[model samples]
Target: MGALDGKIAIVTGTSRGVGVGVSRQLLLAGATVVGCSRRPLPGLPAAEGLGGVEGRAEQWVCDQGDHRAIDAFVQRVVDTYGRVDILVNNAGGTVPTPHAEDVPELVQQIQSSPASDDDFERTVAFHAYAVQMNLISPLWFAIRVYRQMRTQDGTGSIVNISSGAGHPAGSPSLVSYGAAKSGLNHLTRSLAEEWGPKARVNCLALGPTMTENFRAFVLGEQDPEGRAYFANVPLGRAGDPDEVGRTCVFLCSGEADYINGTTIEIDGGMLPGVLYDAGLKTITDLL
Candidate 1:
């Protein structure tokens, strides 16, 4: 039997990217997955090969940023399934694009005009949205699910999907996204401690993973610097979503029963002070 046979799981943001991988892995492990996204979940590409997967999945719509939507989503799951065995707070990707009209002004402000009130307000607005989606939404989902999970017969697992940007060194380009994820990492630990043996909470801080979004925006065929981004990684390549999915599986399975309140880095051993090429050059120059 699969490790998660007879379990019920809730996975958010399954319309694309890491959520797809997480859902695939859970279904393969024999858990009934109820997933959500702004759009319907798409068919896993032919290569994903669902031939042997024991469990099944259903798609639902949810806007994680809204507390009412989260409440309705959780209620629907519980009302239909009678219990929730796992929750994957996997919805996020809130990098705000500066308005076209303000781009030049923002650039000018960065170099010369320090008091750009409009620019500052724009950034704060984006940051607030990012925090709402990445941090507050996950918190709400965890709170709602934990209430149901604790009442169940055995332990329940909550895995918060974070990003490597959340690391202490922080994400310069993705400031707000990184800050929100950092909050999520801390939330994982705090919730795990607060909701003890009855429920376990963990965080997965991901590095560069090859997902649909990655293919479209970050590492597309036309991007020359894309592959260069992985040069410092010991593994010398971005991780695949399936790899992340497997890790999520392990974290949720009984095999990981003892692992709680931990933030596991899914990046291929890329640490702080060593990720950037300049950082590598500084160390090599010393040698």
Candidate 2:
């Protein structure tokens, strides 16, 4: 049997990226996954049967940034599933990345200049909202899951996906974003401390990972800056979606019951020296 046999899970932002990868991995481990994204549900890719993995998912259209939408979506899961076994609150943000031509200088500009109101507003919205989607929303489901799990099975896990932007990899123009994720990283500590040995909480601070957004900027580089940006990565490459997915599964499994309130950095060691080389800001820049 699978580590998660007979479990029900909620995964947000299922239309693509890590959400897609995580959901697939959970399903393989024997879960009935309820996934959501702003995109139309029917358009989602269908289920596939992989060896040693048997699972499936149902899709929902929910813009996680909208408080009401988050409510309704979680309600749907509780209504249908009767109880929630796992939650991966990963809607991220509402803002979409612009086309390369429209914002080709974003990286450089964010680095060179001090932050402006516009920068705080935009990046804060994305990262702060990431906290809401990644923390608050899951808290909602976690409460109900905790009640049900304790009464029934006595276990559950909440995993939040974060970014190294909040770590020593400190971003330049991303003051708001980094601060927001830093808040999330802290929440993992708080939640684990308060809700330990019953409902586990953890965060993954990822770095230089490949996703649809990363690809849009890197794949068709056609520029020296873009090439140099990735060259600094210690791994010499972007992380696969499946790698993040596997980590999610491991955190959710019973094996991780003792591991709570921790922030695991999963970026192939792309912090400090590596991030500095990428032109991202650090303490030295602040001085």
Candidate 3:
């Protein structure tokens, strides 16, 4: 039997990119996966072959930034699935392309206009208002899912998708973005401590990786930042979306039951000062 052969998982932001990857991994592990996003998936029906997962899959549209929408989404999931065992809080992406930012460019924006009031406000809202979607939405989902899990069996997993930018010593260019993620890290640790023996919480601090969004925006033909970005990564490359997905699986798995209140960096061993001091050219030459 699969690790989650009979479980029901709620994966947010699964319309594309890393969310899609996480959903595929969960399904492969044998969970009926329900995907959520603000808009309909452009090609979810055709993208099911990932990891060869046979688990049931479905989707819905919900704005995670909205409190009412989050509650309604949870209710809908419970009504449809009868049980919610896992919640992948992956509903973040760059917003106001008319989207909720998962990560990336917000850092650049913060750096470019560090002192700009408009930039700071826009980054939080993504378009308008002051929702602070990145920091607030995960907690909303976590609380709701925690309730559902408690009612059923007093157990559940909440994986808050974070980033390397969250590190205190992480990228300076991403001040606001990093602040949000750092807060998320704090949230993950706090909740893990508070909801123990019944619920598990953790953070995944991702480094450079190639998601659909990453490819299109960061590494793809339209805008090639090139290999220089990987200069600091000891492994000297970007991580795959599936790599992040597998980590999520393991973090939520029975094996990692004791691994709570921790943040795992899926960053290809990209440590600060380590790679640069070691010399990228020498390492690449040896490889």
Candidate 4:
């Protein structure tokens, strides 16, 4: 049997990207997956290697930022599945902008060149608000599920999606996004403490992964920047969506019952650098 057989899971922001990947993983593990995104997924993809157990995947269209919609969506899942065993809060993104240094150069670039109010607002809304959807909305769903789990004498898991960007000092251009993810890490810890032995809560801190969105929107047609970015990576490439999905599945499985209130970094060793690389400073200097 699959690790998550008979479990019921809710995965948010699952129309595409890592969210979709995580949903696919949970389903493949024999969980009944309720996948939510701003738009509905056309259909669940077939699991290639998993001999016979073709898992079930259901799609829901809801704005995670909308608490009411999220509440209704969670209720629908619980009503249909009878219990909620796992939650993966995975919807979030950075504000679109020109290359990190495409804008006009000016004196006092460090202090004066920070993102604008609009950028901050948008980033907070996307990153911070999305996290809130994962944290607060799931709390509402978890309360219902927890009550049921208590009745059945059962336990559940929660995994929040974070980023390596949240680890370092913070990025000026993506300050709000980084801060929001950092806050998510703390939120995971706080919730784990609150829920305790009854329910497990953890954060999956991811590194750069190659998503279709990243390729089309951020990387652009030529993808020079994207190529350079991945070239610098120690792994020599961006992570696959399935790698992240597998990690999520493992974290939610019974094997991870003892693991709680932690952040798992999945960045392929991008943070620890043996060399004194001043790429950012060098780029700024050149500009």
Q: Write the per-residue lDDT of candidate 2 for residues 1-287, one digit (tens) a residue.
A: 87788788888778877787888888878888888877786633424444443335788888654667766776777788777778876656322223212222244243222233465444434444444654565555455445555654566778887777777555544454565677778877887787766678888877766676555533433432346666777776677767887898899998887888899888877654465455543212222
lDDT for every model? 0.76, 0.65, 0.70, 0.66
- The TM-score-based order of candidates, best leading, equals 1, 3, 4, 2
Ranking by lDDT: 1, 3, 4, 2
Give the best candidate by lDDT. 1
**How much is 18 displaced in model 3, in angstroms?**
0.7
In candidate 4, which residue ranges exceed 4 Å CA deviation?
Answer: 45-55, 96-152, 222-225, 272-287
lDDT of 3 by residue, 203-276 (tens): 89887677655654444452355466676677777787778888888987887878888999888887754423
Minimal lDDT window, size 10, model 4: 274-283
- lDDT preference between candidates 2 and 3, better one: 3
Lowest lDDT 10-residue stretch of candidate 2: 94-103
Q: Is candidate 1 or candidate 4 better by lDDT?
A: 1
Instruction: Give the TM-score (vs. native) of candidate 2.
Output: 0.77
**Pairs clashing within candidate 4:** none
Instruction: Give every collision pair in model 2.
Output: none
Error of 1 at 61 (Å): 0.2
Candidate with best TM-score: 1
How far off is residue 92 in model 1, in Å? Answer: 0.6
Query: Candidate 1, which ten residues in sequence have the lowest lDDT sum?
Result: 278-287
